[model samples]
Target: MKGATMKTTMEKLGIIASYSRPRVSNDNPFSEALFRTCKYRPDWPTKGFATKDDAQAWVKSFTGWYNEEHLHSAIRFVTPAARHAGHDRATLANRASLYANARSQNPERWSGKTRNWQPAGAVWLNPETEISAPEIRDAA
Candidate 1:
């Protein structure tokens, strides 16, 4: 922000970050998703922040909660911190066991297999399809 106009906006809002590179509107999906999460948070202020400090403090708290506590559905409901610390594998195994036990206790209640507690293999903003051996052979 080179002008006073943008500075006023910043003061009212807080530290504004550009997720994309300089002079580019092409933000990656991951950054876009994170921004969505921040905007959709239950405690996100509807009105502008009283001061930039207030906004920064709120963002810090949100980041902590997101990393340390929030269970991500894409990652088998484990916190990013837990996954980063290599604790998610154990956590997922425990959940799988618990689900299996519950299913055994009331097998008829379950219409299908219990939800997969397996750790996510990989994450891609835009996943590409790989050709299977059978498909390649048939094509050839």
Candidate 2:
């Protein structure tokens, strides 16, 4: 009864529970992915961090690597930092050029056009299908 009441209250407030459906994997994909990355890291201690300071240090390091070094495939294999700083355009362009060169040098080895290698103009976690014209124009 208490759970049902709380759910009703939340609904009235326009709040949705993440695990509303049973046996459904509808959680935020980005957060789940980041957690998986952290859990699978080779440096992650099996037993957990020894102290608060240790946890903080590891988190700092992981955040640095995740933002600056990790090549996120969602963003065309560019690091978050590079994409945020508007440097991904040049990086993607360079990659595209390299792929073109490689394909030209070994024509027989390739069967299709080089990878798109185009920097995504905008990355959305959960985008709406009917995006506004203004948002599209701004992204361009």
- Compared with the true structure, what per-residue lDDT tens digits does model 1 show for residues 47-135? 96899999999999999999999999999999999998999999999999999999999999999999999999886544453444455
The best candidate in terms of TM-score? 2
Model 2 poorest 10 in a row by lDDT: 14-23
Each model's TM-score, in the order given?
0.67, 0.75
Clash list (residue pairs), candidate 1: none
What RMSD, rounded to one decimal, does every model reach?
12.3, 6.9
lDDT of 2 by residue, 14-133 (tens): 444455454357556667788899999889888999999999999999999999999998889999999999999999999999999999999999998888999876776556544554
Provide the overall lDDT of each model, using Cα atoms, as 2-decimal numbers.
Answer: 0.81, 0.81
Clash totals in order: 0, 0
Deviation of model 2 at 95, angstroms:
1.0
Task: Look at candidate 2 and give me any clashing residue pairs.
Answer: none
